[model samples]
Target: MLKIFQDLRELPKEEQKRSNIRNIIAGFILIITLLIIMGFTTLGGVNTFFETLRHYSETGELLISLDRARLYEQTFEKENSLNSADKAQQSIDQSIKLANTWNTNKNPP
Candidate 1:
């Protein structure tokens, strides 16, 4: 270790300058490499976030449209069944009465 220190102290002036330049260059390269990797990592996370938002928006729009379509379909069905309206209403009334009777008779509190 003493010999190594002595040799470093005896090194040529031009060689010392070159060594300093090399160290500076290596340090700059390492910093730039880290910045590039961080940039890419941030870009990837941003892309994934936007992708998830896009899919969520599309899914919400699809569900809303489906709900509207179902509502229109049910409306159309009721309108087209006008000829059998009275019979349908009577059947619904009878079913409600039956359900009420069962509820009142079974496990009543």
Candidate 2:
């Protein structure tokens, strides 16, 4: 590298200017390449984070629905009312819907 610079210093003024321009272009290319790689890596990490958050949210909602269904079932057992049975069925349906949504989101085509 030192020998290369020594030869460059010996070149004519116009040749030196061209060499400098080439060096600048090379530097810019290197910087741009690095930036693009970093940008993609950062974007991938962000996408993963959001997907995880969505999964957690769906899981939480599913759990809540299940809990509600359990409570309704217990109520129906105690009182033997048609209304409680219907509510439990509705909660089970909601839980099924959430699970489907979560599955679809987790495995997109």
The C-alpha RMSD in Å for every predicted model, in order, reads 14.1, 6.9
Error of 1 at 86 (Å): 25
Candidate 1: what lDDT?
A: 0.69
- The 0-to-1 C-alpha lDDT of every candidate, in the order given, reads 0.69, 0.92
- State which candidate has the highest lDDT: 2
lDDT of 1 by residue, 45-69 (tens): 9999996786666555555555555
- Please estimate how well model 2 matches the true structure, expressed as its whole-model Cα lDDT: 0.92
lDDT of 2 by residue, 23-75 (tens): 99999999999999999999999999998898898899989998999999999
Could you tally the backbone clashes for each prediction?
0, 0
- After TM-score superposition, the amount by which residue 34's alpha carbon in candidate 2 deviates from its true location, in angstroms, is 0.6
Backbone clash pairs for candidate 1 read: none
Indicate which candidate wins on TM-score: 2
